[model samples]
Target: MHIQNVRKWCREFAEGHTNVHDEAGCGRPSVLEKPVTKVLFADRYVIVREIAKLIGDVSKTNLDKILTDIFNYNKACVWWVPQMLTDEHKKKLMESGPTHTSPAPRRISLPNSVGKPLNNHTALTWLPVTTSFQNLYCVLQ
Candidate 1:
């Protein structure tokens, strides 16, 4: 193979699209190291060589194979919690900002009273079951 082919092979291998499958699907490593070594320790796990023999012991060749073995294209979708302002932030906003509230009307309600508006004077009348004559007072005010 030409030197250009070697470079192309290295690049392709780093992307982890090599043909290494059995009757079952091929297993790929979780991560790939920048420079392939005898042993690469990832944050999750240490990836040691599965096969002991080293056909191409050089860093470039080793890196290519290791990268081809690991670094799967399939990515798992995960829900990530983002950083947000805390209760302290809300308290600060409340202290610095103007407070808002609904306005309450100043009026009283009577249990059996119904109110109506009229421009003319009206007479007030009443009926009493227990007494003989019942009177009611009213003003135009």
Candidate 2:
């Protein structure tokens, strides 16, 4: 790797490089509810509705993280204090959440102290309308 690249990246960050998954994201994600709508998501991940609803495979490990983040964020609770999940929690997630044939790769955003975790694809925009890669990193841990 080029040292210059590191410098460029560092200058783009705030204080230093942080992780998006710093906060505690464990167990099944809480159900998604319409902040305005009264209908409950049946305590299920509506990620199905977000993209294509085709019944396909979702990796277990990846789904676990997604579920954990979804659950905590849904409840307005911290998402990355723990950084991981337990076996029992994983089992619970499988039992409670959607079904997939296999574990595929995944990319997810995170919760933050300031706003929210930016999706892997979502560009980061810091306060004062400034764009920052460092500020964009998840700052829970």
Candidate 3:
């Protein structure tokens, strides 16, 4: 609290105003509600700092709270599809389709003494397989 505020409260108490609570216009009211709503409607993925820049006066922390509490909007995921996808890219994805299967697992030929032929089963035994080289490297402790 400000020293001026403390002194004013003390004066009020001495002058018979027993209520310690402040009067109606103690602090500035929030000016964020409209600006936040407008920006969100324009682009839902806008960053909080970007919105603060647009508003100019609002702090990022205050704007963030207003967004969460009053607007009830969480930050969007950045991992989704890119903003612009070329037609060629879309066509390629469509051709690939949802059920694209990986190539057939190639067999890994190891020395007979080691064990059975290693394929995807090597992954189960906590071994890494180099598919391009078609080989398995065993790690010795």
Please provide, for model 3 over 1-141, each residue's C-alpha lDDT reduced to its tens digit, 9 standing for 90 to 100.
Answer: 999998998898899999877689788877778877788666554677788898898788898688777666555322222123345544644554434466442442223312333333322221222221113221210
RMSD of 2: 20.8
Which lDDT tens digits does candidate 1 get at residues 20-107? Answer: 3343545764233543333432211122232223323444444435444453311111111001223553354245443466333222
TM-score of each: 0.15, 0.21, 0.38
By TM-score: ranked, best first: 3, 2, 1
lDDT of each: 0.32, 0.35, 0.53
Off by over 4 Å in 2: 7-54, 73-141
Instruction: Give the alpha carbon lDDT tens digit for every residue of 1-141 in model 2.
Output: 999978866775666756534458767543432321222232222343331223234444443344344333232223332234345544543454435875532323222223333222333221112323243223222
TM-score of 3: 0.38
| Leading candidate by TM-score | 3
Number of residue pairs clashing in candidate 2, backbone atoms closer than 3 angstroms, sequence gap of 3 or more or interchain: 12
Query: Judged by lDDT, which candidate is best?
Result: 3
**Backbone clashes in model 3, listed as residue pairs:** none
